[model samples]
Target chain A: MRQRISAVVIGASWGGLDAYSRVLGKLPANLPVPVLVVQHQHPSGGDKLPWILDTRTAMHVVAPMEKEPIEAGCVYVAPPGYHMLVDVDHTVCYSLAAPVNYSRPSIDELFFSAGHVYGPGLLGVILTGANDDGAAGITYIKQRGGITMAQSPVTAEARTMPEAAIATGCIDQIHDLDDIGTVISELVFGLGA
Target chain B: MKMPESVTDEQVSIEDIEIRLLLEAIYQLYGYDFRCYSKASLRRRVLHRLGMSGMPSIMAMTERVLRDQQFFVTLLNDLTVNVTEMFRDPEFYRAFREEVIPVLKTFPFIKIWHAGCATGEEIYSMAIMLEEEGLYDRAMLYATDIDKNVLAAAKKGIYSYAAVKQYSENYRRAGGKTSLADYYTAKYDGVIMDQRLKRNIVFADHDLATDQVFGEMNVIVCRNVLIYFDRDLQQRVFRLFRDSLDMGGYLCLGTKESLRFSACEEHFEPVVADMRIFRKRQLMKRETR
Candidate 1:
């Protein structure tokens, strides 16, 4: 019995640009599920991440406006200095609330919100990062009956994040950095499809 | 028997139902309408409070909120995110000076409303800019927030010295013509803003969710406040702002927010698109809401 995945949320911090490029580049443009990415950055950082990701991936990449509806086939990048959450109404909303774990766009904020909204239909992925932000969020997704994945710490540019997630003992699968995108595509699209 | 797809799809979790009841209880007991707020952020805040208070669940918290006025106030503070800084986004101020100031100069007397002006840092920033531009004497700034405590603090016009040091850098980057030190005096780890800056300002408790429009204004600055609200509540606030603005008046929102999806979108034209500064259209006749 295969569950239909509704959304994919990916989180990365240090060495995120290269990790995102390599992973997102593998997913086809016509992917059915919307991919939301939270990459740790400074509050005053440039808004060029979406454009850079767009150049690498086939899917449309955007830093969504407040309350923008979540659409399939587009990759949403969390804007700096704001916590991005998935509303129950299937729209993306931003909050100016105080930072969690010393990060505004905290991976836990996104994952917890998406997990609550999507429930069993959610897919949470933790990638290379220097912090333990996504560990708690992975636990949340697993408790919500959603699937969780982590890039193997050995292959990650920064092992702390994925290692932390794995330590939560919630992740469903562990894949190498090179195979993460392929695993995601398989889980979302199914092998036969 | 197989569960119907529609029934299963529409099912609400017990936790979600409890949160809804808590918000409803808050509205009924305190007259604070948070029912229309975005649930994701609200849930996080509520859960945080629950953890801190060591409540068994949201249901237990709801019961406490109903009976304990003090606990309710604490929950209200958590619900309303009041994290703000002076000249938080310098680029918005820079754009305001370049794009909106020229138009504001044409008006004889300026009326500016800073809705949801938490602790009044942004209001002071605006006052300083307007004073430098020679508009402060002619301007009456209304700084409002839902929290009366914050409003009282805003009236005092004092901030941490360390925070003010960072704001000075922002002030310079925001095209300040003179020294930021000229505006405030330092006193033992804290800086007191010039009392004159408060002369033309009025700090009041105005709830955007419930209160009616107070006056017609030349400019409305409500930044990062709308993100806390749901779509319907945001549309209601947008309509309120639209009706409150004079013809050709300016409306400034946070950088991440946009008027494109609101019902009043057609009534305003973008003055500084990147900065989210919009101008009310002159030709459109006002329609009663």
Candidate 2:
């Protein structure tokens, strides 16, 4: 049997807002897998993302606080200016220790921490972006026996990030942006395919 | 640090081994302790420096670290990047002006401690606030950090002139009584903060992980510093902050940080929840925050 995914990490940049809306909007409510996302965003605009995504998805969407308990069926957005990482007891932790790869809530930081936390039950997806932030991170997820995937470069609003992830030679599948969320719901909750 | 119960020496990879050894070497040679820092973040910083140095391994980097004092200083910049801005998260400052300063004004004399006050952005910001509120003459601000280099920089109070625009905006939003421009004069390529603010400020080298209780204070603001430390170190600092604070003194943390899960939670109650400002409570049973 395919190991059920327990957590999902999504990363994107450049054209992420509309693309995030698409992926998050299409997901079912009972997405047993916890979803965490890191999108390169300006620190000043920290207020609106979770609110915007909440309208798109049935899942409980939030920009979690320091040491907040991470639970299933919720989407946590990494707040701008602070990085979101997982702790030993599975709490959501925030960090201010400078930016990685020029992004504060770096995709690599989230993916690496998720791999450490969920291990074999992790699924990391690299969506549209203009840079290669998540490529090596997905590679690391693959190393930890977690599933790795990339949004189809052709379907992505900007292909650089997804293409970079595919170039890692660790991606298990490449699916269209619209279908990726359905695939995840199918894998985790047996809802959509 | 990684939990000892879950990881063995063998489970930690060679890269991790190199990192541990490097940290050990740095400690043994320099007496600067970073061993208690968060493992993942420490790993990232070491790897970044390792790559920048173009060394094949962290072991090699450690070798260079021992041989060259200058290289170590360069590594220090990478490791302790004090990347902060003035009046960051303007809401917190607005909160300070409206909610905190009023309570502080009641005191005849005020002592403020800005622990882990990286590059002194917030200290200057605090000084300006006190000056506006007519409390500057009576307040003494102790600014401290682990890195002596950053402490020296904090003392200089100079910043890139370009940053003034954003700082001005934040100052206005933070309820500044006077223009933000009033606090600094333009230098060659930067702006030097008004030297008058430095009169009551003391910049010192202090480590949260390995330092003693420095003083009794009415407010202890250690924002964004606890996030770097592990659980044990965080608790240690909380205890330090708790003991050092006067009864009913304020404790301000980074907007994202909390004492809710910490050992020190029982000693503090939220002054304003949204602003992350807490007041020291009398020793009592753990009630709700």
Quote the positional error of residue A15 for candidate 2 in Å: 3.4
DockQ category of candidate 1: acceptable
> Which residue pairs in model 1 clash with each other?
none
Candidate 1 per-residue lDDT over residues A1-193, each given as its tens digit: 5878989999999989999999999999988999999999998776788989999999999889988889889999998899999988888888887788789899999998898898889899999999999898888888777889999999889999999998888888999988999889998899324
State candidate 2's DockQ: 0.33
* Tens digits of per-residue lDDT for model 2, A125-183: 99999999988778878877778888999998899999998887888889998998888
Name model 2 segments beyond 4 Å from true. A1-4, A26-30, A87-89, A116-120, A143-145, A189-193, B1-12, B285-289
Compute the lDDT for candidate 1.
0.89
Question: Mind giving the per-residue lDDT tens digits that candidate 2 earns over B115-164?
Answer: 98989999999999999999999999999998899999999999998888
- Write down the lDDT of every candidate, Cα atoms only: 0.89, 0.85
True contacts kept of each: 0.48, 0.21
Error of 2 at A118 (Å): 4.5
DockQ values for all predictions?
A: 0.46, 0.33
Q: In angstroms, how far off is B14's CA in candidate 1?
A: 1.5
